[model samples]
Each structure stands twice: as structure tokens, then as C-alpha cells.
Target: MNLIKTLIFDFGDVFINLDKEGAMANALEIFEVDTFPEELTHVNCRYEMGLITTKAFLEFYATKFPNLTQGTILHAWNCILRDFPKHRLAFLKKLQAEKKYNLILLSNTNELHIDWIKNEIPFYEEFKSCFNRFYLSHEINLRKPNSNIYEFVLTENNLTPSECLFVDDLKENTDSASKLGINTWNINPETDDVTQLFDVNKRLF
Candidate 1:
């Protein structure tokens, strides 16, 4: 609605396709570990919280599989990297040009995946420039769907939750924002095209 003055977008599946399956498969092979242990979720949480460096993550994996090299673990961790769709970027750029809302990117991302983006994506800077503020979870030391993160964004941006529209692929992330009065759009990137959420021309205004 017209009350929405800020558009907070999630980076991963919302704007890009992440190869989780590929990453897991690669991790299994490279780590020489039977599979990702249940503790992996906790480890990933710590990584996203910036508690552990990329090297530390690799070392942890290597410790589990003595035969695995640092390079192998790093590569396995990076297997989730993928290309950002040009059309989606063009849409975001168009939104920026419209100046209708203050655009912000809020993502729970780690250094390794971000490094891959910098190297693999030619339009990384251009994509970044579209947002008024870019908040990476690791950099901020906060990750969704943590309510503290939602509060942090609101307080830091001086944005009322009601005036913000949070778009994310994950239900839990949006749910957290929604609880704070932000409008939410759960964009299913797998089967749904994001551009159809609103007409590019209309949003440009």
C-alpha cells in the first residue's frame, strides 16, 4: 500500500537461485565425511552470525575429515553459488530509478558465498548500487529470522515496521518481520517469477 516507504529485500533465493543440493553433494564428496552432521545447522548458524571465519569453517570440516584439504572444503562450501538473473536485476534497477521507496537489501550471507559473487558476477557493483543500504548478516553480526535483526534494521534505518515491506523467499524470515507490522511478500523463486509481483512501470513511480 501507499504506507510502504521502504522495501527490504532478501538476497539469496529472493533474487538468486541457490544450489543447496549441489552444495550438499559436493560437501559430502569433498569432506569424505559420510554426510553433513546434524551439528552442521548449528555450525552454519555460527558462520552466519560471523562468529567463525571462512578459514575456521573450512578447518572445522577438515578436522572431521582428516584427508580433506582446505581447498576441498572451501570449494564444497562454495558449491551453492549461482548466477543472478539479469532480468531481476533490471527490475531492481528500474525500482531504484523510480525513487518511490528507499530500497534496502537484508541478507543472511557468509563471506565465502559473497566472495564468489564478487568474482563470478560482473554486475555485482551495479546490483549493489540499487539499494540505499545493504545489510549482510555476517557483517552486521545478526541473522534472520532473528527478531533482533528485524528490530536492528528498523532502529538503524529509523523506519517504522508498518512503513516497510519485507520480501523474502523464506517463510520464517518474513514471519518475523510481519510480527513487527511490516508487510511481507514470500516470493517463491523456484516456481514464481518475482517481476510479476508488481508491474515494473507501476513500481517505477
Candidate 2:
């Protein structure tokens, strides 16, 4: 706890509530797919990493699912995002005010989703202001569960992995960071909240 000088957080399911299951169900129903095919998955990955423009990304979907309207595609894409709790912002602001540790926000998000958030969440800029560094997978072209993304954060910030605590909802992502000697908390979004960070990870905090 004492050694941790940096706190790395995942945005989705950490600060912002995401209806992943519901969104997936919606997408499946809308797209008429039992599961996303590899091509769609690959294109999604590329879009997240900013390998393609939003126009191109939307065009891909439109080309494939011509019957579906653009609004429907956009709706299904952004549906995963839900309300962001203000208590989490309060906690983060307090942490920032204390100047006790470096705060960083890391998330695998694409342009449309971020655009939607910025437009929807009135306090989006305020929330972003709390972090020393904010890395979006689309902006950085590096998604987590991939070790290099963690490595890039460590290198770019000149942070010692052992001195940093990375919190994410996914085990695979935390595991990747953990392998680099970073302290991690694989939080279950259903049962945990970032506001309880210090209390939840007593050993680390």
C-alpha cells in the first residue's frame, strides 16, 4: 500500500457503468447474428485501435448490414455505456486533491463511443481532469490484455510497475499487467465499486 505511488484505472465498468450483456444481446438481435464473426471482430479491434476512420467503420457495417439503419448501428454500439456515478468522480477528485498518487485512466474505447460520452456526460472534462495521463485505446492504438499496452504506459510515464496499482473489471487484463510486476485488482463490477478501492483492496491500499 505504502509503495504504490500510481493508480491505473479502467474506465468502463470502473467509473462508467456499462451494460455489456445487454448491449451484446441488443447487437445480436439487431445484427441477426448468433455471435460476431471473426471479420466483424477484427474490424472492431481495428476501429478500437483507430486503424480506421469512423466513416470507414460505419461504412463497413452499412456495407454488410445494409438493411440496418445507421441509427440502429450507432445505438447498438453506444448502448454498452450507461450512467457514470457521481460518487466515483467525488472519490477521484478527493484523490487528486490529496496529491498522494499519480492517477491514470486507461480504456479500450473507440471514437463514436467517446464522442457519445463527451456529448452525454456533462462532467466528462471534469472527470478527465483528475488523471495525470489518460490513454484511450483508439487514441493510442494499444488495447489491454496485450502486454505491450501495459509496457507502453510504464515506459511513457517512467513508472515502476511494482509501485503502481492497476484496477480493471477483466481478469485477463489485470493478469497481463500483473505479469509485469504491477499490483492489480480484478474487480467484479457486479459486486465492487471504484469508490471502495482503498477498502476493497486493503492489502494494496
TM of each candidate vs. truth: 0.90, 0.98
Worst 10 residues of 2 by lDDT: 196-205
* Model 1 TM-score relative to the real fold: 0.90
RMSD of 1: 2.7
The clash count of every prediction, one per candidate, is 0, 0
Residues 1-205 of candidate 1: C-alpha lDDT, one tens digit per residue = 3767898999988787788778888877765568777887799889988999888887787787788677776777777878789999998999999999899999999988888899999999999999999999999999999999999999999998877888898999989888988888888777766676564223422
| 97-188: candidate 2 lDDT, tens digit per residue | 99999999999999999999999999999999999999999999999889999999999999999899999999999999999999999999
Segments in model 2 whose C-alpha atoms lie over 4 Å from true places: none
